[model samples]
Target: MKTKDKIMIFFLTIITFGTIWIYWNSKKKNNKKNELSRSEKISFDINDLILFLGDINNIQNVENTHKKVKIYIKDSNLVKTEEIQKLKGISSTLVSSEYVNIIVGNVAEFLKEELSRKMEK
Candidate 1:
């Protein structure tokens, strides 16, 4: 084979390998992200609760304004309201469609502030 043809083949091989490497690395990262998100679906801490409050999807609706944050879950059947109620001044109410709405008092403003600050960053 000609020198030019060999060099072209070598470049093509390198490009193909580079593309495959990048694709595999990105796939691994996506899996990790998925796992992390799944593990973070339900959090019982101050920080995670704040992040959950910032998410509009996790919230079904809001009634009465105050420091309380309301969270409605579709998997309420599997969730224990007692555990959720144990969080400081939180209260839980069972709603329709396997949904449970949890009310957490005296922390809405704090969560919003933290969410906004994080968004700016």
Candidate 2:
């Protein structure tokens, strides 16, 4: 093949691969960002709830009025039962698993209260 033709072909190949790489990387980044922004629904096992209440003490009026509890945590899925227990254990009133309903505006609070109530039993 002529030198000019070969050079043209090489450049075209490079451009095509570069475009594909950039597109792929951008798409991957967008997906990661979306995942970070999305909210997560977390379900806690009964045992984990008990451990959480042992840690937190400030939580008051913890009552279990629902058979099942579900909460939405925005932008995070990591929940430590130990940390929740620490916060609820500090509450002035003893948590009860029978009739207490701790309501919060955010997912973290909801989980904290629910776990605290479960532990109270």
Candidate 3:
């Protein structure tokens, strides 16, 4: 083969490899970004939930029952039912005249613990 042909093939191979490398790196970065955003969203939801329940002070008690977290509030009027319903992972909310009940699938225990810790602090 001519030297020109050999050089062309080499350059073509380099270009192909460069494209693959760039694609792979971009995919990895995108995966990381997606993971970060998901975690941030969960954290934001938990924090916002605390506020919607009328802060740590208003929460008199927290109970976890499988997929549900029942929060006893000092003043039911302070709870924001509309905002709580809009949160991402909240499966359902059962607001009574005196308390707040939220279902967050398997994260109920975690939610209860977070609320308890916040109250302690």
User: How high is the CA lDDT of each candidate model?
Assistant: 0.50, 0.44, 0.82
Residue 92 lDDT in model 2?
21
* Clashes per candidate (backbone, < 3 Å): 0, 18, 0
Number of the predicted model whose TM-score against the real structure is largest? 3
lDDT of 1 at 66: 53
User: How close to the true structure is residue 33 of candidate 2, measured as C-alpha lDDT?
Assistant: 48
Q: Report the alpha-carbon TM-score of model 3 versus the true structure.
A: 0.63
lDDT of 3 at 82: 91
What range of 10 consecutive residues in model 1 has the weakest lDDT sum? 34-43
Encode model 3's per-residue lDDT on 27-52: one tens digit a residue. 88877643211111243467798889
User: Can you write out model 2's per-residue Cα lDDT over 1-121, one digit (the tens) per residue?
Assistant: 9999999999999999999999999988877643212212344354544434343232333333222233322212233433544443222222234322323223434455645565475
Q: What are the per-residue Cα lDDT tens digits for candidate 1 across 1-121?
A: 9999999999999999999999999988877643211111223465544343443344444332353443444443444445555665556544445344455444454444444454454
TM-score of each: 0.33, 0.32, 0.63
Ranking according to lDDT, highest score first? 3, 1, 2
Winner on lDDT (2 vs 3): 3
